[model samples]
Target: MSSVVDSTCEIREAQLALQRDGEELEHVEFTINSLYAEIEVIPKGNCLLQEKRHAVQSRIFTNSARISPVRSLPTEILQRIFKVCLPDDRYVTPDIRSVPLLLCQICRRWREVAEASSELWSSIAVYDLSDKGSYTAMVTRWLVASHHRPLAVSLSCRDAIIFHEFPLAPVLRWWSHTQHFITFVYTATISGLLD
Candidate 1:
């Protein structure tokens, strides 16, 4: 019967498909086994490479023992060098690139030296004291840096009209306790400025 023939063809097609699937499965299994073998060897090679890198780093570190010529100097000599960096006869503006502050930024060693040198921070100048809050903070820092030493402060009144506008009471109170306080105020005329 034609039905029986159709069934026979269907059975043959199914068997061919099963054989194809079995071949594909075997190919997939081979690929997976190959990847597993590669993975097993990878850790050994990776560990060896890591060890080689660490050894090279150690050698580099040993060779770089004398990286900076300045580091060889004694602390006393270094402190003198830091002192020479400051302005000899001028006020240090609140600038980022100036001597004492810049020295602090150079490295930890320089920072310690600059910080320990109280004379470097003893001189302070106020070009404009309009901002009382900022002036307070700056004065506080200068006092701390002076380490109970005398302070040489210069106050410049840019505008006589705005002189009363500034907070002078707090400034007076802060500098009162200083042992040796030197204050210089530059003005064209002090006639009615206080009024």
Candidate 2:
């Protein structure tokens, strides 16, 4: 009878230990689940933080540009700066890659300043009169942009006949009325004749 009682007590103790271990396992599983939820949120939170940082940086850059020295320069001083940037060539070509046209392309304010500065458009060289139609229109626009400022026009052709064929109506009209000093340079290469 005493052996039976001892067996029963041992069995009860084993059951209690198992119950306690099961409760501890449940607590560990709960903790793991909570950690997984926090991990999932971290990436989303980090993305939001990054977006706000980018926005702030962009604003700082914009504000800094607004206070730049070049932006604050007077229009007259800016025009002088544009003049200084003009090409050393005898006459300005309508090439968009060069200074005066390049200056106009920078921004609206710069375009306004460059276009208004008549001196920037006062000189032009047309290297090809083969496309007389386009050249005439281009020359007329260039002269008009000069706002009656004295013009230095350079025309180059392979044949003198091309020069005669070029409609000089626009140039003549400007020359007839304006008292401003005008310089005209004509160049022709009559291959064998020059040699």
Question: Which candidate ranks first by TM-score, i.e. highest?
Answer: 2
CA lDDT of 36 in candidate 1?
Answer: 99
Worst 10-residue lDDT window for candidate 2 reads 170-179
Once model 1 is optimally superposed onto the true structure by TM-score, how far is the C-alpha of residue 10 displaced, in angstroms? 50
- Stretches off by above 4 angstroms in model 1 are 1-66, 132-139, 176-179, 182-195
For all predicted structures, in order, the TM-scores are: 0.53, 0.55
Clashing pairs in 1: none
lDDT of 1 by residue, 1-195 (tens): 999999999999999999999999999999999999999999999999999999999989766755867888888898788788777666665544776667777777788877788768867776665666765555566666677776677766567654655556655665666657654444423556666
Can you write out model 2's per-residue Cα lDDT over 79-117, one digit (the tens) per residue? 999999998887987766776777877878998899899
